[model samples]
Target: MRVKVEDLYFSYPGKDVLKGINLDLKETDIVCVLGPNGSGKSTLVKCIEGLQPPQSGNIIFDGTNSSKLSRIEIARLIGYVPQSSSQLFSASVFDTVMMGRKPHYSWRCSDDDIDIVADVLEQMGLANLSMNEYNCLSGGQQQRVLIARALAQQPELLLLDEPTSALDIAHQLEVMEIIHNSVHKRGIGVLMVIHDLNLASRYADKIIMMKDGIVFACGAPEEIFTKENIEEVYGVEANIFSHEGILSVIPVRRSDAKLVPESLGIF
Candidate 1:
């Protein structure tokens, strides 16, 4: 699937969140959105998923206008993984993942739904935990279960919000690797909102930097991860190095000499 966002605008009362945002995503590519908080990263993903409608402009998916589609219509083609998972219920992992098949089924789950859930659990290395309570899993294991649930949807587009935010270094890489493999092997487009610059540089086929509700830069990682671009978007001084074809971003210090943008206030 291909997604094209054109001249998109969105706002809350007394606040304009997305300003003429435009982005293109391809099924075989992994795209990462990097920006300071309140830069409209999550809002952009919500607009695309039809969770929050844009105030103006269009989101076209595979040549269809999103404004014409209903929420369930969009959900059939797009799978979203949020930043965190808090399973409050004691539902079995298999049952939780099977819920992703809801869009396809009008009644109870069929044999095909069962097969798909089993397959995804195996792929995520969670087959052993299929019967276990979802709420009992470790953080990393729960994350994988959620991803497996999304995959069970058989979506053409996957939107992930800070997929690794709560993970340790090893689990972070593991999650990213699964996403990367899905893009290459399953031919699904992935748009990830990530704060880790090094992880974005290493895994993303394209990187987009947003500042003040608009795109500051968009290109391949090598093109977008320049020192000046980092400083401009993040308000930080950083050394970006390329080692063995991989880029590593080492932030030296915040640019305290410059005033922080009002929009980025923690409150």
Candidate 2:
């Protein structure tokens, strides 16, 4: 799926969130949105998924306005993995993943749905836990399962928010590798919001650096991950260098006395 976000703006009654955001997501592209907490990363993903409409601007899906697509239509084109979910009951892991197949099936799930779900479970190292209670898993395990579900959807594009926030270093690398391979091998477009600058730098074909609910920079990782950009976006000074053939970032200290606002937490 190809998506164009044009002049997107979102806000609450008292404060603005996304400020005239614009970007392009193309097939076979891995685009990562990078920002501190309160920069509207999550909000931008939600708006793109049409879960919440932008107060202004348009999200065009393959040249069609998001408003013209139904929820089911959107689901067929975009697989969304949110930051977290509040499950009211202990649904089985297999069933949780199967839920992503809803848009593809009508009276009942097809054999393809079952196979896809099973494959994603195996890829995510959760095949053994297919029958386990989802709520009983640890935070990292649950995050993996959520990602598995999104993969099972078999959508053209995947939108993820903080996909590796709960995992240890090993699992984080594993997940990033899986998503990277998914896009490169099959022309699946992925737009993910992540905080780890090095991971984004290494995997993303394009990087979007956001702050104060607006995009401060959009370019390739090497161009967007400059020392000045990091200091401006996160209020921190950092060392940027090439390490072992990979771009590396090491934060040195707070850049200034100005602290990121606590009130922007909800945005």
Candidate 3:
């Protein structure tokens, strides 16, 4: 599915969160939203999902206005994974994942739904945890379960909010790999809000940098992760480099003064 946001504007009672934002997402692209806190990254996802209506402008999904569609209709196209994976109940992993099929079902889950859920559990490496209590798992495992639930939705567009924030390094990479594979294999467009610039540079087909609820820059990782761009958007000094055809970002430490090491004289 394609997503097109044109002159989007959204605001709270006294605060303007999204200001005249515009973006176009294609089915083959993995777009990452890079920004510090309070940059409206989550709000942008909500707007695209039609959860929070934009104060002005239009959100077009696959040539249709998002606001004109029902929540179920929208769910048929977009699947959103929130930053905090929910494990509010003591439900088993299989049951929790089966909930994703709700949008497609009228009353009861069909044989196909069961098969899809089982397949997703295996794909996410949670087959063994199918009967385990969701709340009893590690953070990374819970994250994987949540993502599997989203994948079971069979959506054309996937929106993830900080999908790896709670995971360790290994699990983070694992989850990202699954997401990348899904997008590539299913032709699903993905938009993720991520704080890790290096991961973003490595995995994202396109990057959009936001500052104070507005876009600072938008382009490929190589074009958007320059020293000047990093300093301007993040207020930090960083050295940007390319390693084996992948962009790498390293933050430069700032200090007020240099210190000399003191050594004790021997004998």
- Among these predictions, the greatest TM-score belongs to 1
lDDT of 1 by residue, 1-267 (tens): 999999999999999999999888876799999999999999999999888989999999999998888777787889999887786667999999998899889889999999999999998889899999988898888889888888998889999999999899999999999989877878899998999999999999999999988988999999999889989888788998889999999998777744666688732
Superior by lDDT: candidate 1 or candidate 3: 1
TM-score of each: 0.95, 0.92, 0.93
lDDT of 1: 0.90
Q: Can you write out model 2's per-residue Cα lDDT over 224-261, one digit (the tens) per residue?
A: 88899999899888999998767889998777634646
How many clashes show up per model? 0, 0, 0
- The candidate, 1 or 2, that scores higher on TM-score is 1
Model 3 clash tally, residue pairs: 0
- Per residue, candidate 3 scores C-alpha lDDT tens digits across 22-65 of 99888879999999898899999989988898999999988999
- What is the TM-score of candidate 3? 0.93
Candidate 3 deviant stretches above 4 angstroms:
254-267
Top-down lDDT ranking: 1, 3, 2
Judging by TM-score, tell me the better candidate of 2 and 3.
3
Per-candidate local distance difference test: 0.90, 0.88, 0.89
